[model samples]
Target: MAKRKWLRGLALLLLVALLVVGGMYLYGSSSGTVPPATVDFAKLSPEQEKTLYARGEQVFRAGDCAACHSSPQTGAELAGGVPMVTPMGTLYGTNISPSKQHGIGNWTADDLYRAIASGVAPSRKLLYPAMPYTSYHQVTRGDVDALWVWLMKQPAVEVANRANAMQFPFDVRPAVALWNAVERPAAKPFDASTDALSRGKYLVDVMGHCAECHSPRTLTFALDKSRYLEGSIIEGAYAPAITPAALSGRGWTRDDLVRFFRTGLSPQGVMTFRMASVLDHSTSHMPEEDLRAMAAYLTQDQAMPGPKPKAPQGEVNVKGEAIYVGLCAGCHGVQGQGQPQSSVPLNTNTTAMFPTPINLIRVTREGLQERDLPHGGRMQSMPGFADKLSDQDMADLVNYLRQTWGGQPGDVTPAQVADLVKTIEHGDQ
Candidate 1:
């Protein structure tokens, strides 16, 4: 009698657990409130179509869609082969071109809206958070309608999406519903109400999605809202803090911010790492007024303390100074004043000023390629020193830069550099 009662209790417990799991899956698999589509596609006149096409192009540029979706080999804007690395695994951007076989050509505007705003694609496919739907949760439906018209009009590419390389547990696509139930925000439209500041917030937070990289992530890989835009290490590089105070402390002005977006160069520094793609695809193409508004939002339209040389933080290392003179002083002067359009000035450069030395180390070891920037800006090639420098040598050189120009302590060690090297190499893989 006792054994039969125990088995019955065990079965009941299993049934209860199954019921809870099933209920959670049902709730998570469903999308939150998606706003109604603003335009009637069938009834639009020629003039309306023209207006939507222009607005959609603007929306696409603002979203920086090409940076991820464009083909690195062919430079096809929506062919979608770029790889995004994360802690869980690598996810390739999907083909968004207008091909019915491989792209979204058959998707109605409402389908596009559901995908963008609620993170639910057709057939209830849940997109990985790498798509930035969290930040885009508040995007306006009107902008999406315009984007749909423009996207559908573009030439279709027949490229199929590359399979994701997610490790076990994450490889199960349906399991994403659990993450969604816990972390995803409800979709809502942003109110941009004709105010510059409001519009700037809309552009930066909703469309630009800057916080997706700049903000630190929780253990679950969701963005930590408490420290929004305070800086974080991602893909082996540090995305620096862009809070108004942080920007002002690093000698950024509103005009300089506009200049950086417009040209990818300012006294602050040149765009590097993932931001290089951003410059090529998005900011450089943005309008002057929009750029101004972004800058205004970043700086809160406040008067800022301009670039000034930082005082040396500690005793300079003799070996580090020698390395700088021997290798670096040719382009960057002995005093760190860079040549015109060739290299950025180091004294006022913000890389070393960051809380972590990861970017400085990464850039030094990897180097930057020569490139023609948009809007009359250009930078010569900077050579990588990976083969030439030992771990100790890199630590010393980075320490020297931090002390002399960054107003930071010379505290990096060879062991720390070796660990960072592993991280950099892994990210490259």
Candidate 2:
């Protein structure tokens, strides 16, 4: 009787495995649909073409193309060697530069548009969702065409394409099809009725793809649109909530936001995280009118209820306070006050006040450096203490900063530090 029961259980397991494989096979074999581009280049005059090309450049910047496509040190503009970390695996950016040998030089305008709108490559492979095609799909056809033109015009480098290091089933392109069929929303026609609102919606949802970093994902890795930009952690940085409810007591005005979008600075602090990258590559280049439209749309009808400062300063370890005075005080200022001349401000900074602890932990361990901010000019840098400070010391130090400087109460643990270390080093699976 025992022998018979074992045989039945083994048979059941095999049957289940076969069913899953068969379902995947069916999903993978099917080809996804691609829509046609909206703008008709054939009918346009030479002057119109020039205008479209310029418009396309703005759109590309708005999409923050350089953040991923251009490598940090060695890669050419849009040559694509940056590696993007996703839950499934690591994905390397491709050479979209127009090099006929290794880049998209051979790709026609239609192919480019199809890739952007449908995430379907000309080679018939299904591109990953990490490229934000779901959001790009909603972009206007004219803008998409303009983007294509601009991309094709860039100097093509002979950089080789890098394969994604995704796990078993995810490594397969067809698997993305099944994920898309369920997760990807149908592209809606541009609604021009709301004027600035429609433009804002398109810019935020498509061009900006703000939700890509700010919002959390579902079990299958789809953006949880219900929560919208309520904020989530991305690659170890705290992307704090930007909604009205979240911004209520923060005291950041629309003017502050508009200025930040252009200059990457605010009264609270400088754009220190991935946001700094966005401002450098994208928002700062946008037209003033478009930027205002985006601001109006983002803030909507929400009223700013002035400042609501927290309670009295909390206690921090003496050692942590000493570390702050010795290393951090000169720049960040004592008791979290930023140096008057520097862009760095601490008393009302978002990094310390945010409920999430990743940014603080990261800045403490890795430190922040001023990189290329072509539009915003060069900002200051912070030297890292990864080697100098232990996990406990760093935690105590951060806790001290939050309490004394930020008027926020929080505690940090060594174990949390360990997890953050892992996250910063290995990235998510």
Candidate 3:
């Protein structure tokens, strides 16, 4: 009996040691998160050359590469180091510069294509989803090929890739591989239909990558297919739905979209600094025809889906409402009218009116940077409350806001709150 007990204790120690070693190995493996390997660009003929460069320019616009890669604030064009915050962690956009050591100078065209389309490094390690490989998977082979050619010709710089500040469990690269294996496919093709709108759909679905921001995601970081283009909370800002129902209230016209895409401003109002920043660097450069097609495609009824069914509410929800009144009503107002000129109205605002629970949770936690409001003269900004409020408080506030003013009634689960909290806490948003 004594010998058996001793053996069991030794086995337990071994198990614990194995777990620790496994964890470190997984962590160290992530250090090989380099871009894909280089391709033999000299293999392409002259005719293939012009086409590749042309296609590269198009993909560049659609993917919004310049938006994050170029440091406009620092006047460092394409010497990347932009910070992208998400609900999971803060990702610093790295130098795609051709410098051999600091950037992807050693990468070939094939390496660029693989990274653009699949989000895998040349070393085959899975990239964090924050890089938007899930949406980029839709990019066509031709487009990927073109993008690679274009990126290869760009001037090289020696800026090092920044270390990602993601939290544990999520910081593990093997876990990211698991996520990609389970939630995403190895590849996705553009939808083929004869309609012009369908071609537009192909661009947005694949190359344009609109779904990266527009599509809502589940707690596991998988796209919520049922709610595609239904909008999601990104960083502290809510990427509002492009649906007719969502846009209908905003009174957006096709012309309005055109103007917004052209200059990041329209008669209806501005798209805000974050969106403006996106458009200034990317969308504005897109061909007018493609922009028009994108606008038409987004405005279509077929693109946007309906909201999900509400769950049965229990007595706990009733308790949550009481909590909202005691906490939120002071600033948001009792009638949800908001503090006029000081707070945004929760009843009719585009974000508040949306049925999804994401916006509410996001707003309560991160709060809005009022200065970034698009139509500053017309709208007031609310501060982020992440530090002041608990995850439950945020859920209750969101629940109350959604049920009472958002035109949806569903119980906010603690699990959802916890997941979002983790994302935000980890530096995602």
Q: Which candidate is the best by TM-score?
A: 1
Would you estimate the TM-scores of all the predictions? Answer: 0.94, 0.88, 0.65
The lowest-lDDT stretch of 10 consecutive residues in candidate 3 is 304-313
Candidate 1: stretches off by over 4 Å: 1-24, 27-29
Q: Candidate 2: lDDT over CA atoms?
A: 0.74
Candidate 2 regions exceeding 4 Å error are 1-37, 305-309, 316-318, 340-343, 372-376
Better of 2 and 3 by lDDT: 2
For residues 1-429, could you state the per-residue lDDT of candidate 1 as single tens digits?
A: 999999998997776566546534765545777677788889999999999999999999999999989998898999998999987899999899999999898898888888888788887788888989899999999999999999999999999889999885466676667777778888888877887788889889999999999999998989999998999888889899999999998999988999999899999999998999999999998999999889889889888998888899989977888898888989988988888989899999999899889999999998999999998878899999999999999998999888999999999999999999988878832
| lDDT tens readout by residue for model 3, 1-429 | 999999998997776566545644544433323333333466878887878888787788788876677764564556777778765666777787777887777776666656766676666556677677777766666677677777777888666677888764465565565455567655555656767578668667776677777888887878888998888767645677777666655556666676667665443334453575666567777888877777777777334322222232333356556766776678766665666545655554445455545656655666555543222333445566778667676676666656665556556776788786665454443
Model 2 per-residue lDDT tens digits across residues 47-158? 8778888988998888888777876668465888778887778888888888888788988777776677777777766778888887777766677788887887777788
Error of 3 at 143 (Å): 0.8
Candidate 2: pairs in clash = 99-156
